[model samples]
Target: MSLPALSPYHLSLALTLPGLLLLWRNLRFRFYASRRARKIPHAQERVLILGASSGVGRSVAHVYVKRGAKVCIVGRRRDKLDDVARECRAMARGGAQVLMVKADCADPEEMVSLRERLEEEWQGLDTVIITAGVSALRPMMSNAGVEMDPRHPPKSQATAEGLTHAISVSNAAITGNFTGPLVSALSLIPLLTLTSRSPSILLLSSAAAVIPAPTRALYAATKAASLLLYQALAIEHPQIAFTFFLAGTIEGDFRASAVDKALPPNLTSSGSGSDSSEPTPLVREANPAKHGLKVGWVAQRCAQAVDRGEKNVFTPMYMRFGHLFYWIVPAYVEWRARVKYRYT
Candidate 1:
């Protein structure tokens, strides 16, 4: 059976509809942006940023510091936190306070103590930005060949060791990417709800959460968990504003500290080195000439999204189409992802 070809009217409609929809979306975004710009400035607002010692967290701290916000930066490394605090203070406007705290976001007791400290010092909290997450660049089945039988797993010494290492790496990703942010949010939401009129929480998520990609199974799963956690929180708390910043690849050394120990060091720009109490060089340095978006620009966009109370923000703008594209063409998306991530 032969089918009739599409008419010119149908082809024209197919081409024109997308353009009209895009124009409508742009207008709507501009309308909301203008409204948000007129809101109260961040001057004197209390903000707490987790994982602020490096990467996007540090950049976000700079953004809020310039806006004259009382910023508290938290991270496990005290030396790095101090360096960030110093930078924030230097950039502070209108006496913006920069407090550096050494703590792990996955620790409940530490989060409690942090909440108490904020209450004591700042009286309340207005914003909380969570950017503490580890990256994974290895496939999920990288070590599966060592122990194929689930019923008789870890039969040999080599297999046992391999499995143990793989599990540890997976645990690190979950703890850093999901559990840590969940703990921090649970501890701080109460204070935010009680204190601020327009409480905001910005989560530095990744586009991988929605778009599947090779070598990103663990990373995407954990990030998706965190994203959904915040989305649920948004539904439960109507007064608080939540912004999930789903960013694409940024020009930085973030891969240096990936949880996947099996990944070759050469694949990353540089190694962060072993953990030390002393002040060591920062791992996540930004390179403007590198591929992808700039860290500073992404940070500014995150801040703007929080101010506007936007539910989801996709950087590079075009990343918003990724989900739809993947839905329409799964094989092509998978192939592109493999090529981009350098996975076979």
Candidate 2:
């Protein structure tokens, strides 16, 4: 085949193509931003946050309080919830109220009580954020030891049969990572719908929902399931905004607790044994700040998404590449993921 002559016009066009595309991309992004710039009226908003005592949820509460919204923080511990409420109250603008409710979302009775409390206190909810979740880092069959608080009874005291029962109990608790949040959302739907402001439900899910995560198969499945649930809910309920956050790593004890709680009781270790005496190392304890966004920063982005009525939120926006890449070439992405996130 005969080739065309190398011309100055071709060279100039080729040289400018990259810059032209870059300019177009930037302009498109600016247009989207300008459209999302409408201010979210926060005055009189009644927001209820699950897992709000710590981590990203806690930070979200602070953001809402600052924007002059009545905020309720829920967690497992009363003391921790109280501390969070105090912090939010201090940051609140105008007369925004902060309520601390110590309730485990996994417990049906607690969720019901939470509903009653919200109805009594705020009368209705403007925003409901479900951030309560536990990590499933270890394999399903692994005999990772159960977490024992010094203040509570040690798992070492339980008999073999009792240990088996405890394991069963622990597995149920692990299931709460999904069930609890689901119940919380359903229980508060009526209140959320009745809000004076634009009602929204924000679910803080992990990027693991879409990306393959080794040694975290169960965790990934649960997250993916949650996203699917809300995506459907969004379709069914057009009047309400259902936003799902496919978030990356952030600073928190969620990983630690997940590892601790999901672990089976150590069968071999007992009192006076050297193995039992030493401290047990957690599954994966690396500084999230070194690898991912800060908790407070991610929370602010989430709040902004609510303000903008965005249906899907991705933190450290670069994560969109992985999602896009996986869909384009699943095999290639999976192969790379296996090598990059090899099971330990």
Candidate 3:
């Protein structure tokens, strides 16, 4: 069967609907944003932020404190936490308190203690934002990087091995990025003193959950698993508002930290020097500048989502389309990935 060629009018007609839809969406978003801006009034709030020492966590802490929220910042680094606490204190408005708690998210005991400490210090929490996660970029899953080559010997192997082991153990256990936040949220939710009618448990996820990019199999798997857990939790626990911030690459120190914790392959064997200690091999990292979003913008968007009691959110909102597109035509996405990321 032969099809008739489209005339100029037909082509124009085809574009009309899409153009109208775009205009409508823009207007709707503007109205929605304005209403949310007015709705989320500044007042004292009890907020617990995990991994708030730096990056998106720190940005969110600053936003909350600026609006007169009592913020508790948690991270493994005491010094970084203290620095974030100091910044939060300075940024705080009227009577906003900033507290720093040093703890590891992967540690059940530490997490339990964190819950107990929060219970003692504050009556309840209004919001719990968990943004602690680890991701390493490697060309392949098995090899950490070329750092294990004989040309390079590490000054510290025990520490690297220990950290890598912990990351590995957590990845396998439910307590890693997969369920650590969930467990932490569950422990803290019980102590939630709801300031507003809707209390929120916000998880900071990644777009990798749905994108399925290369070189991030473990990272993407963990994040996707976490989303599923939270989505199910949302249905099970209807009393609390459980939301996810599915973020893209953001301008933060997360990448740097992940790289630092990344251990060289055969770290145990490579730790010992052979007469001459070779210089540490540097892992080639992608410049996140290509895809990074500003931490402040992401924080603000997340804050609005929490206030609006949204269920799922994507930073740089347009990324939401990619999720829908992937679901609608998964084969297209797979083909695109294979072409762009060179995934076999």
RMSD of each: 7.5, 7.3, 6.7
Q: Write the per-residue lDDT of candidate 2 for residues 216-320, one digit (tens) a residue.
A: 666787788778878887887787777889887776667765633433334433332233454333344356657757888888888777655677777668678
Q: List the residue pairs that clash in candidate 1.
A: none
- Pull out the clashing pairs in model 2: none
Q: Could you tell me the lDDT of residue 57 within candidate 3?
A: 89
TM-score for all models, in order of appearance: 0.81, 0.75, 0.74
Q: lDDT by residue for model 1 over 114-200, one digit each (tens)?
A: 999999999999889999888886555443223112223332333454556667788999999999999998999999989886788
Residue 57, candidate 2: how far off, in angstroms? 0.8
lDDT, candidate 2, at 13: 96
lDDT string for model 3 (250-270, tens) is: 876676654334444444323
Model 3, stretches more than 4 Å misplaced? 1-41, 144-175, 193-196, 259-286, 338-344
Q: Report the Cα lDDT for residue 38, model 1.
A: 53
Better of 1 and 2 by lDDT: 1
- For model 1, the superposed segments whose C-alpha errors exceed 4 Å read 1-40, 143-158, 262-289
